[model samples]
Target: MLKKITLIFISLAIILTSLEAGTSKRKGTAGAEELRIPVGSRGVALGGGVVAEANGVDALFWNPAGASFVNKSAEAMFSHVSFIADLKVNYLAVIANFGGVGVFGLSLKSLDFGQIPLTTVDAPDGTGETFSPNYLTAALSYSRRMTDRIYVGANFKLISERILRESAVGFAVDIGLQYRLESGLRFGAVMKNVGGNMRFDGPDLEWGVVIPGSEPGAPVRSLRVPLQEFELPAAFELGFAYNLKVGEAHSLTLAGSFQNNNFTLDEYKGGLEYSFNNMLFLRLGYSYVNEADYIFNSPSFGVGLNIPLGGTLEASVEYTYRKVKFFNNNQFLTVRVAM
Candidate 1:
């Protein structure tokens, strides 16, 4: 136990040192911004502070280590988010637990931006054409119970983004660790979106340009503008949670987390949950950043219900609401099934 604890601290120190060294002054400059968006409704409702207690398929997007805590043999979840600026996010995840081997998970997240009229330098108003942008991420995850109290997990992700004829593809990884105590206390840490830079390239970046002072009737030279590569938004997070039993049928959980980002300000988050007989749940959460102009600083609210369909079969429905500063508020709905 002492060795395990020391190893955890050593790993944390290494990751923290690397993150500090990689910090950048340029904020909001990451390319794969979609990866930062929250997927599971439960985690979003918890203000992203549920890293320690997240479980089953819901953990695929938060802390993969928690995926090893699934009580069922298999679990699947589907979620939809009504995001700000009229955008929509859809997420799906499935996980299967093997008795002594490990747990494997697969997940996909996609963003939908409705068609928008194309515009150009010459046609500032409209170009009589419309295009839809596509952003998608697919991830494969593995988690194992390293010890009675230690859980470890990792996720390998493929990211793709396209706008018209230009497209960018990249890969990233997430590593997570969780430690649970018999006293209902949990600790978790995760590093997300660690990868190389991504650059856009396609036919749209190439065009024919004539030299200024060439010969008469000279052929036009094909010019291709080079695009700058952008780094991924990497973040390191640490969190803890305590589960308290109020009575035989009632319980409460309190969770808090601190997140440090490479390209943005650090954030602090806290969440509270009340549960009745493990069937009904109510949650309240809030997140704060040092920056005063952060858009998602408001409180979030959520509710959930779990029902047993039959022997070894269960279903859950959850919803969350978050207030946005300028744009419309964000809402999420999720359905999960386990057997």
Candidate 2:
């Protein structure tokens, strides 16, 4: 436990140094690509409830430290998301117990852009070819309980981005802590997407430029293109959840989280969920984030079903729908199995 704390502090110190140096420049604008990726997931299932009610491998994505409470011998989950336009995202994760001492997990996420039209200065109009941009990340994580009520986790991630023939790759790390106060109350915090800047390297780097009018062409020279590399969208999250039991057949959960955005300001997310006899659940959630001149207000709804598979094995399916402005509503589905 002390070793984990030391590593967390070291990582934070590096992050602070990088932020102080890079943010001083005050760049021109933030890209749309940065705004599009890392869209929050699984929050729709939280439904304003506290952390003790949170369970399964999905918790690793939301709060890695929560994995310490997994009672199942092994767990696996898969989620597919249909995002704005034609973009799609898929996530897979698995975790297991190690002799009741700790839990270790692996997670992978992929974002795919179908095809985009390619254009050139010569063609101006269109090149009649399409380019696809792909983003992928893989993470390995470990979580351990420090006490009966406190837990901690850390993750190491490798990230990559590819567009057409150009690609950039980098690595990042995440740390998290969760505290369970009671059977139905929980608090959690996590720092995510912290790592080194990525640089683009590919065939595109082979292009050359001619200096403007240098003594009537003093031997055409090759010029190295400047690559604009920036920090990942790192952020911190604090959340609380509470569960209320009403009789023996029904329960209500409420959850809320505050996100401190690194590029922009902070955002708030809240949700509510109702479960019936531990067999079915219905959830609704809302989120608020500010853009330059507008607000990206999204509301989501979800449903979950739990099925018994004998010998303590359990299976469940979950679906969530979210409405986005200026685009078709998004949909996500996940399947989970635990023993």
**Cα lDDT, all candidates:** 0.90, 0.71
Where in model 1 is the C-alpha error above 4 Å? 10-14, 21-25
Task: Estimate the TM-score of every prediction.
Answer: 0.96, 0.84
lDDT of 1 by residue, 1-339 (tens): 958775886788677766753333656677798999998778877888988889889998999999999779999999999898899999999999996799999999999999999999999999899999999999999999988889889999999999998999999999998898889999999999999899999998999988999989999999999999999989998899999998899999999898888888788888999999999999999988876678989899999999999999999999999998999999999999999
Candidate 2 positional error at 3, Å: 21
Candidate 1 pairs with clashing backbones:
none
Largest TM-score belongs to which candidate?
1
Q: How far out, in Å, is residue 124 in model 1?
A: 1.3
Question: Which residue runs of candidate 2 sit more than 4 Å off their true CA positions?
Answer: 1-41, 45-53, 209-219, 290-295
Highest lDDT against the true fold, candidate: 1
The deviation in Å at residue 260 for candidate 2 is 0.9
Taking all chains together, the TM-score of candidate 2 against the true structure is: 0.84
The TM-score between candidate 1 and the true structure equals 0.96
